[model samples]
Target: MTPAPLTRAAVADMIDHTLLAPQASPADVDALIVEARKLGVYAICLSPSMLPVRAPGLVVATVAGFPSGKHHSLVKGAEARLAVDQGAAEVDMVIDVGAALAGDFNAVLADIITVREATRDRAVLKVIVESAALTDAAIVGACRAAEQAGADFVKTSTGFHPAGGASAHAVRLMAETVGGRLGVKASGGIRTAEDAAAMIAAGATRLGLSKSAAVLDGFPD
Candidate 1:
């Protein structure tokens, strides 16, 4: 059976409209909220510091462990707990890429579990796996660890990593690893409608994009 063509509204609903730049000011986040509302996005992803923001009708997501996943697991858990307390409905926590790369999925699972316990059902948890920096085997391992740790989603990248961002192959692998049990979020460096469509076709259930309006504009209504 052929799949239906993706519509602009459908794509917008899949997007986590993002503004995670380190230098972004409170005013910039305010502007991002306005843009997200206008674009009809599902959520707005921001730094944890930007929490307590109001994006009525849109899910508010914040990051823990951030661009680098080197933080101690306890610290990441605390960050997630605090963000949830501050009104963030979702938390994307970065895992230690080094653990995955070193074939230590047990450590990865433990790290994610800490954050999962901290959120305690108050927020949806997405694990950022830094897929671009990992080998395909590591990606699979990381995704499996995320699932075993009870994350709600497994995200591709943080967009700040020097290596790269989301790709169709990574999204596919992640989706297959979780096997419909968890959402696959294709994030980072996705700037065009074509890119967004490809990720969806590859089994990404969610998207993370900094250029939400431009990408949505490229799609037909």
Candidate 2:
């Protein structure tokens, strides 16, 4: 489907400029904020410990339970609360992929709800379903779980998974499932402007990019 190309400002507003590396230091986060400001991106995503990223205009988002969603729900909730307390404006929590894979949608919903309530509307709660790792039905089921759990957004991948990262197919399915009720975030391995555009066309409301500046540089003014 050929969709309209987004204007620079629109594209900027859709980005979550990210730096989720394991060894990322405070200095790197400072640098990320500088880049985010220069690029006019909407948010700067980081690890939970890198919270309180006082980037005046940018939304500060952090990950909970990280690349693996194996952590218990309570543990993830506590982690999210801590990040929020540290000044994160949004929290991206990983769902237990195994539970979803096992056809246990109930567990998945409960797990996400735990963190959602912990966030308590203080921050946007995005649930990462690791789309690259699941079958289509599982993907749909997972998105439903996020919606039922009252998550603010449904995300594609963690970028740390060996399986791979976001794909246009995943984003389209997520958008179709959620329609207008919940937001969809297409993240991981998105390296260029065309990649960003494709996700947007697929109905993703947000784009997570470690290489946000470079991608934005390729967009037309």
Candidate 3:
């Protein structure tokens, strides 16, 4: 039988309403939290500096190694640990893109493992692979490394890469690579409901969206 059509509410539940602007103030983050609660999103992804925030019914997520994944593994681990200590329930860490580009997936695995060990049982670890900047082989290798490193999810982009953001092609490739063993998150450049749906159809289990309200507005009740 065919699956029932997805609803606006269902899609909202799959979103991590995001606000990672470096210039954003506490007031802006407060407003973001308020909006996330009102939207009924599953989580809020913010920068680590804006953490320790509380959103009653939603998960709190933050990034480490951020848009650039050049940080040392130990540094990323420390950042993840601190984020969790600051009340973040989920930590997204960027894999070293240079390592992946250089075909050093073992290095990628080691990097994620450090963050995993730091978060250890305290928070969920999502590895951001920056898919748009990678080749298909690199995407697969990164996903595999993340899985071996004990990541709970494999995410596509950081929304800050000039290489651009999530694509259905990239999402599909990532989904196939992980083979449902881990959650797949499609982020970056996802501005419309149509883009969201395409990612979902391509096997994305979660979405990172800055334009949450605008995208949700396009869906039916």
Candidate 4:
């Protein structure tokens, strides 16, 4: 069965209006804050470097170990802490997909734990599992590890992975695994109201969308 339509407030609350593109300029960041304030989006996910100057009055967020979760755990942890100190309300850290696929579950757990500890008091931590790169089992494993590491949410993708974006199956798996304990963020390639509703129906409490304006524009209040 299809899900009911999401109210404007519900859609607004679920969005982490994102601007992670390399071409994102200072003016773009400024415009983002203006739009976010107008829409009252859940947060404005920005690049870490922009945190110091652009974080005020914004629900500031930074991506850790970013698109490619290949960075050393220590580096990700340090980045997480720095982002928090710079006034980030939330930190989205990518999991080491290589380690996860190789069955190095300990490495995956350790990586998320490092950032989890670093951001414990300062900001909420969301671990991006990059679900498209993993098999169902791997997704479950990552969700379990994220929950164990005290992550506030288990995110679906980084939008850079060639594997693709949020899927209903992946969202359901994440929700079934971590819904009650930790929130699920369905990100990457979400561009329409219908897509947003599908992800939410599949159990996404948060959505990271770069195409926020288009999505909301198509769904008038």
Query: Can you write out model 2's per-residue Cα lDDT over 82-103, one digit (the tens) per residue?
Result: 9999999899999999999998
Could you tell me which 10 consecutive residues in candidate 1 have the lowest summed lDDT? 49-58
**Which 10 residues in a row give candidate 2 its minimum summed lDDT?**
1-10
In order of appearance, the predictions have TM-scores of: 0.99, 0.97, 0.98, 0.95
Where does model 1 exceed 4 Å of error?
A: none
Cα lDDT, model 3, residue 149: 91
lDDT scores of the candidates, listed in order: 0.94, 0.93, 0.94, 0.89
The superposed Cα distance between candidate 4 and the true structure at residue 129, in angstroms, equals: 0.5
lDDT of 3 at 56: 85
**Distance from true location, Cα of 160 in model 4, Å:** 0.4
Expressed as tens digits, the lDDT of each residue in 172-205 for candidate 4 is 9999998578999999989998898889889999
Better of 1 and 2 by lDDT: 1
The candidate with the higher TM-score, 2 or 3, is 3
Q: Which stretches of candidate 3 lie over 4 Å from their true place?
A: none
* Candidate 2, lDDT over the whole model: 0.93
Question: Clashing residue pairs, candidate 3?
Answer: none
TM-score of 1: 0.99
